[model samples]
Target: MENRPDKTNKNNRTMKEKIRFYIILTLILVTGILIIQTILKPIPQGITGVQTLETGKQQSTQNSITGLGFLQPQDIHQIDTCIGDLSSTGAINPGDTVELKQDIYVGSTDCLNIDIANITLDCKHHKIIGNSSSSANGIVSNKTNDATVKGIIRNCHFYNFTNKTSIYTGKPIVLKEGAKYFLIHNNTFNVTRGITLNKTIDVTIANNTFANYSTLLTLYTDAEIYINGNLTNQTNETTIYNNTFEGIGISTNKPYAIYAIYANDLTIQGNTILTSNQITLDGVHDFYLKENALSRVEIKSQSSNTTAGRIERNTYIDTSTAMHFTSFSPNELSNISIYKHDMVNFSLSTMGSGVEQIKIYNNTFAGPMSIDLGSANNCTIWNNTFYPDEQTQITTGPNSKVRNNRIQNGIFKTITVTGDNTTVENNIFTKITGRGIVVKANNATVRNNTFNNITGIAIIIGDDTWQPPSHPVNVNGTTVYNNTIYLWVNLTTNTTMHSLLTGLPAIPGASTGIMIMPNTNNTNISENNINEQNIYAQTPPNMLKAETRGIFGKGINATYTLENLWIHDNTINTIREGITVENCQTTHIWNNNITKAGKTGIKTENCRGTRVNNNILEGGTYSPNIILWYKTGIEIFKSRAEIIQNNKIDKYHTGVYIYNATNTTSINSTINQTQIGIFSFLSMNNKILNSTITTRHIGINLLKTNHTQVNNSNIRNETGYLNTTGIQLSLSFY
Candidate 1:
């Protein structure tokens, strides 16, 4: 059996070994060829294409892709190639085209399956009519993990995808599972639904028209261009430009024009959109919206990530809101800039607690426009013009700033700041009929503002009446500085009878320039210039006259004794009192120059520890002959612990009338051209020390007073009036 090891078996074994070796060699050669082919093949980058012009000549094209808010266009290589026409539904390969010759009716299946990459489907303006199939679509591109499909859909019309029988997902075109670099241009959609993009990237929908017909009963809640994304594959770099969306024959419950969810980096520019609803961005980031004429825009994000964007050069017409922002968490929507927008019949609002750092500038809001910052923090509004038909209202939240704005015409009612640490500066309010700025917050500052021809009060701090402790009183640390107010009534149009009939005050600045209410502590009013002209040719009969003040402070029914008030360095030319403090404590009025004071320059009633020092008061032809006895320099009525020092008063009936006041001191003061200087009536412990009183009548007149001392003073009748006495005492104890 060991003889030569069976020669036939050996020969068969050798043949088997050779066959195995040849098979292995063939596989190796095939694999080597495939590897070489893969290495030498060109890698496809972004959209590279050649566009044919009207002359039928091809040219290389590099198109710009739109991005998220306020971004410029980015150029990329693009391709636009067309193959022969095919009229049926089938799979399309790379470099293949499906061009429709006539209208095709789709039933239960998709018209074209774009499973492969780099394909074009042109319908040549023919319609793809869907007949009530829930899943039927005109074109479908479905890709998987790590795979991309590039598609172009142009010159097509989609109709009747209403899905009346079942759930309505029967869109015209559906791109899913990471479809990238798609260009959809020159298309028309007339259906209840439009195109849908799921998990797509680098897609642009331009030069298209989307409309709803009369046969459409209700539009779907999804937008015309509905974009959706997930956590892993976010929809990025999508642009909708040069498009037209018309919600024809639809009024109520109108769908959105473009609604994106969980998307990133979007550009919506150069589109004319007319819809009753909104263009919503939900959970989106990095958006640029410019040069678009639309109805409304809403940015709402509930995700943990930040939503930041820019909206500029846009026009919104016939809508209730031009822009609205909403968020769920703290600081979720931030760093949004809005500028250069023209809105008609629109409003801007931030209706979220999580919005911050918003900047709005260089915008024009015409007629019936308002701004409401609801619970948003750190917002800024500047350099805008507001022209309202009836009223203009602006409201802000905490740490907000409003500056350099022109609020003119219409009512111009109020700018309400309802939060702490807010600033309103450099704003111009002209031709207004109501109050200018109302600050209901702590640490608020109103500075460098101009109020011209305002018929009502300029600034109001804190509440006029008493409120509960739950809603605590604000304006504790408020400051009003460097503001100019010019108030006048038009005598040519308004009569004193009309003013009296309308309950208007007889004196100018009757509503006051700056009004301080009760419980307003630590308030500073300085460096303000207020001029009010109450010039009338004739006086109305039986009209009630009231004292109007430039800076007025008062207490209400429940709360009294306003403390720590500092009013200094103010120039007031009004028809009544310059500074008045009633039922207040620790009030300071210094360095104030007051002219044309009809009644009193500085009046303090029921006040304690009030100091009026270094003030110049001049009554310039303001005393009417009927009410000449009502004019005075410093009237301290029912007040105690008052100090009137270093004051210059001239042309008044009485210089310092301390009536029913106690513990008062008038020191180092000068009074000239007055009827009675330092008239103390029914007062106790009053001292007139080291003062000069040069008057036409009595200098120091005391009636029914006790412990009154006039020491180190010069009292003279410089006017040489008849029966003028230097010191006249009647029923007094000294």
Candidate 2:
């Protein structure tokens, strides 16, 4: 009877605890039921929901459908058998996707014809194999004249269509007229021809690999065509970017990786092309070609205008002709700019007329090149560096400017300006083996140029040939001023063999500073510093065939004469001849300082109305190694109406030698430190007045001269030899 009262209380407490445990169990069971229901129930499309499945894996239920349960028979058409004819199944409708189950073999006519819009054909990595006798395509759209058919064909393998009898034979895909908004991607084409898009619009072909095809893709009359990351061939309002082109075509005669004809608004960029051919553009305008690695590029305008383009920062490697611009007619081709390019073994050739406003700057050329601006106007070439192994030529047009360029180790004429109103200034020419700058135009100003270690003529003015009808167009009104010409004849020994083997003209050991060619008129050569250095002869005597002079003005053989030439305030040092004027008329040479001349300081032959005034002509000590055949300070031969006045002539074999001259006068001139002071041979009517002549042998020696008078002159013989005479007249005719 002791625990009987506590038994009731214990029972009541246990009952309450049992109620709480039952409630907890019921809640747990309801939560498990709700989770199972959520996992099994379907989720709405594109709505995010989390659920744990029976496999204990959490997954997002947003637009997630597993298995093939959701595919309707009308939406997905399975291709189990080979297609022989397309008319049996009618056209593929919109929102339909055809899946390839097995490899299909097609007949010769039509495999799958599509004339409807918004259809997709996926091959599921199965090949569409064609028979050798078949000329059918894997997919083709019929011609919709005024209507557009949009479709997509992807993940298809086209193989072994070997028939090439016709142009359309062996083509895998053909999009006919009025096809728009079609996407062809991730396909492999191994047939004879890949795809053809004719009159298509807004087509994108990407991520396709084409191998061993005649042409990977051909586009005709298509606009807004975007090609990216594909290996294909030949586009307007077109973009060709990030594509790799291997070869040109099946036939080796085809030389274009991509050819666009009558295209407009094209953008070609980021292409890596490996072919011996070029990318060609014909009748194209408003183009941008940038950031490409290409072999060559060609632009041609025929019956249309190609205007306003840019070619920037593209690399050309191991190509022969990098860029070529041509026009069939004069059609105002204008506004082209090319800058910041790295070129190797390349050139630029622009031909035909009506080309204007071109700019080329900041390019580095490693190998030899030729930049020809044929008949182009208003062009600018600046800040280019050239390291050429062979001959390099840069020819400019009218109103062109070539400034601030550095030419290193060029073998031939570096720059040539044949157009009028051209300016060549501030150019640095170093180690040039041939002529540096050649100007054959009128009204040219070549100033502030530095030529160092040149082996040939530093600057040449006037034409070399006068092939009749192109008569020697005089280099009239030309000024060559403030030029620094330093010719190092010692550096030209190795170049002789190269010149001889290539049949190039030999560069003279005694190179010319400036050469004014025959019939040059009104030329002014002033303030030039020419240093020849009197370099020794390293080649054979027979091979040394160049006439050396510091400044030479030449004329045709008494027919065409150089007129109105002025050479003043120039300094010449260690040269063969300081200045040589031949067959010139009305020439004035004044205030020049010449030193260490190996031969005549100032020589004029067959000149008329010549004046040599206030010049210092000094010859160095005679060396037996040098060929001193004509070591005279002032030599005048066969000249008429010549005046030699107020000149200081010294350190020569003969101070003044006048031969076969008429009406010659030497007044107020000082001649000293010579063997013979004033020597005349076969001269007539020459007057020597108010002159000081000091020599060791003879003062005034006249042989076979007529009517020569010597008045008011002082004569002194320093050596005082046994037969020294002040005024000896021998064989005087009158």
Candidate 3:
């Protein structure tokens, strides 16, 4: 502005001065924008520091630099790339090496053609790496074998850019077989291809960045192939390495890392892959994947994939398990040798899931609540350490042989029943929070097992703690037998939480020790030592469910029946309910020690044809156990005919209460308790015979019941609820 050039004086300056001014202005504006944007869109505060970038430069040139229509013939006479004319360079002769200088611009239809032989039109490779300023690309040489040129061109960038052409087809720097020893090295390829070695061999394409090229690969599309799958013969001994791939073709797809079809003597190592898709595809024939550490590598299977490749000692770490692999066709046409590996460890404390074929023989685990397993094949587990965090360890589907395993400081429960026909024999299951063995499966043999320091809520009243969810996902028939279970609910809900303890009664954690829903039937229990007071202090016994609702709304009086149930030989030290048969038919309960009961021994509501016989009923002497017959005239939601036979009953309060179940038959069972021995309210068709009774109250009292036969039975009391009469006869049943 100070000394503005006059209109006439501006003509004195040379044209070079104007061009230099424009270039300087462009650089100034770029520098200003870089400074302003750097402030306005400030750099992000990463964990460490800002990432550093690397940079380099390259220059390319070709022969025949000068044209035939040169205004000054002498200034641009030489064939050096220093000349700048192509159309007028005249035809190339045999043995002529065409050198492409740094500035050789070709128009859309303009191509360098050669009809001569023994010519070398080469592109000496120059690299524009990912560490370069932005995504950079350079040059391409398509058809140069038969003549016009011979010689190498180095340091020319190769990229599929459209500085001149506007077509959507990406620009490619090609090299056909006619070109040999085409030393193409040190080039950066991003969003473009460097040199597609088609029908070419002995090519060296190294130290290049094929960056973000395989971007549009789809489920059915196989893009980003460095060379054609069928053209491996072109680059038989090719070498590709030290490249970082971060395109969609690299995402979750493991086959795009390094692909060499039928290629020989290939080596790939030291590559880092960080794709959101967790996998990269790498294919090689007799290939080597050594030191090629991957976040995730996917091995693919081809239609005619029969060659067994080698996979040796590659470390893979996946945090989210997003890393995946596909069988090389079928079952991988190969086997991999992993010297050492690690599965990402996390807290697996959540319980009650359905898993499969997981063998936990003799290993220390962090936390896995419910793990299902298949039949063990020649696998034996002995002397291992187990620590539980949930109420149950395993739920279903396995045949695990666990013997002599050291279980220490566990929580909730050690194992649970989830699947069908499994065997758990001779395992020490002791922990705090839940019962040692919680049965929820069918045909399960639980024998020779010891349980200590278990987790049970209370003793006096059952079901005082938290109950199970009403809606069960997968619950079926189960058999419980011959295992010592020591429960200590006083510790806490489970092992995960030790400071906060739930001191409720009635074995709080799960709804019922064994819940039988509609889909669950034909269940049996025998010979298991289940102690519940070690967990909860002075806990009450629960007769049925801790808290019943919904499907439990159908709990004791459910319309659905649990058929073919056999409850026998179970030593119930303290529990909510011993033999609770609800909506079941033809249930047989026999020879179970209902001593030291928590709430009650046997409870049957809406049950039909139940036979209970031959059991020692002792120190339940403190609690008044009731056997209420909730039978109705209607067949639906009603119970029928229950027989209590030949058992030494010793308890407090009372013996059996038959209510509404009119046709119940009680025979051959001894009774000795505090209050009444046998009391009936609207019960009928019962036979009381050959049984001794000793109690503080009535011997036999019938209130609104009939059709019973009493013979060969010794009964002595203070007139047996004399209010009813000396020999009472009532008609409640027709």
- Which one wins on lDDT? 1
Q: Give the TM-score of candidate 2.
A: 0.73
Cα lDDT tens digits for candidate 2, 558-637: 76788999999999887767898899999999999988676788988999999999999887764336554467889889
Model 1: lDDT to the true structure: 0.74
Error of 1 at 416 (Å): 1.8
lDDT of 1 by residue, 1-734 (tens): 57676888899999999999999999999999989988985543432232222221222222222331111112222222221122122223354554565777776767665665655666778888876645777777766563446667788898887754455657788878667788888999887667788878888889999896533334434467888886667788888889988874364554577888778899999998876656887778888999998878887766444467899998886567777888776437887889898776667788778888888999887777778887778999999987775677788889999999998774645588877899999999887665688787889999999988766667878763334443436468999999998765443332332233123444432346787877778999999998764532112321124334578777543355578899999998854667888888889999999987767888998898999999999976433345567678989988899999999999888899999999999999899888888899889998889889888778889999889888998888865466677888899986
Per-residue accuracy of model 3 over 1-734 as CA lDDT, tens digit each? 65666754676566668889999999999999989977885333431211212112222243232221111111121121211122234433333444443333333431333233323344344222221222221233344454332233334454434222322333334445454444443444454233444444444544555455454443321323244334234344444455455443443433344444434444455554444332332333444454544554443434223123333344443333322223332322222221222222211211112212223343443343333332212123345456645433543344544466655555555555444566666777555443345444455555677756544311101111223534333334455567666554433232322111121243334323333444345666677656654423224433332321100101323444456777778776554444465667777778877555444556677878888788665544253345322211101113577777886776635566566674566677677643666666666666767767765556666667767666776665533443322233454443
For candidate 1, give the lDDT of residue 572: 89
Worst 10 residues of 3 by lDDT: 68-77
Model 2 clash tally, residue pairs = 0
Model 3 stretches with alpha carbons more than 4 Å out: 1-477, 488-511, 535-559, 621-638, 717-734
